[model samples]
Target: MRWMKVMMALACLGVVSACSVVTGGPLVRPGEPTGVLEIANGSSHTLTVILIADCSGMSYGLNRLPSGSTIPPGRSYRFTTSAGCWDVSAGLAYGTTIYETRFTTQVRPGRLTRHTVTGR
Candidate 1:
């Protein structure tokens, strides 16, 4: 019976450890005279992503992604902008929670600049 108790305790521990928590964050990098926005998913399961961008009083861009888009646990995807100031937010679909970020584009004279966003 002592061995049975030990096994039961181990099984409980395993069950508790198997539960995973999901985390999401924004990542950015420098692109060619432009800016790239990246969102990172750090969880054991898949996540639904929504992207919204504020482009300097111009147009707002919206994107929706399905679950299992599979950013994986340690990977990132990039979003690029055409013009103006850029603000990006990413959140899980069917949820009100969101992460917001603001970044500027580096447009040089006579040359186009591109910025890249990374989630590492």
Candidate 2:
């Protein structure tokens, strides 16, 4: 009788545990409608750094280009990001000279946003 009762209790406990809601996977959700950003180096300098910040003024946290990578003059680089408003900053390689500083642009999903950097 005691063994039967223990088994019943175990079964009841299992049923109770199964009744509780259980969820798994990513704890945080991602932004919707990702888009692309195309930066064209229309200047005489090699494009080195690309910084992106959201409309809320929060930066995307780092340079969009990989280390040691650069877009030569007349070339362009594309970046995939969430669709929304952004602030773009582009500078010359190995110097403090910036051709485009905090240039605001809109990125739409399923669309390409093209921005050209001049030698200003």
Candidate 3:
């Protein structure tokens, strides 16, 4: 009976550990340096929406750009975040145009990671 109880406790511990994966644990642990993510607009269209997701997330959290703002062609925007890999998407003003060139780039500590979106 004791052995069976031990096994059950171990099984519960395993399940709890597995829950971290589904819970979206921290991408950058405490005390880690952050970096800059530069989204450069090489495409002719103005960018009205920019969303970024940490690799651990199920979906993009929110639009990083400020409300009523836009990034015109040849311009760029930067975000300061924990140094790690991220997925990025940028779209046009009407939300009808999403650049197919999705970004899965690595950001180094205290460095700049640039992902440029060009024409189709």
Q: How good is model 3 by TM-score?
A: 0.69
Which has the greatest lDDT? 3
Estimate, for each residue in 1-120, the C-alpha lDDT of model 2 and write its tens digit: 999999999999887544331211111128578778899988788988887766564343456688889999999999887788877878775376455545889888878999988756
Rank the candidate models, highest TM-score first: 3, 2, 1
State which candidate, 1 or 2, has the greater lDDT: 2
Candidate with more favorable, higher TM-score: 1 or 3: 3
Q: Arrange candidates by lDDT, descending.
A: 3, 2, 1
lDDT of 2: 0.72
CA lDDT, every model vs. true structure:
0.43, 0.72, 0.77
Between candidates 1 and 3, name the one with more favorable lDDT.
3
Please tell me which predicted candidate would have the highest TM-score against the true structure: 3
Candidate 1 lDDT by residue in tens digits, 1-120? 999999999999877544311111112224524444455555333334444443433323434344456344455665544434454444432236433333444333333343332321
Candidate 2 lDDT score at position 105 = 92
Tell me, what's the RMSD of every candidate? 17.6, 12.4, 5.7
- Which candidate do you rate higher for TM-score, 2 or 3? 3
Single out the weakest 10-residue window by summed lDDT for candidate 3.
19-28
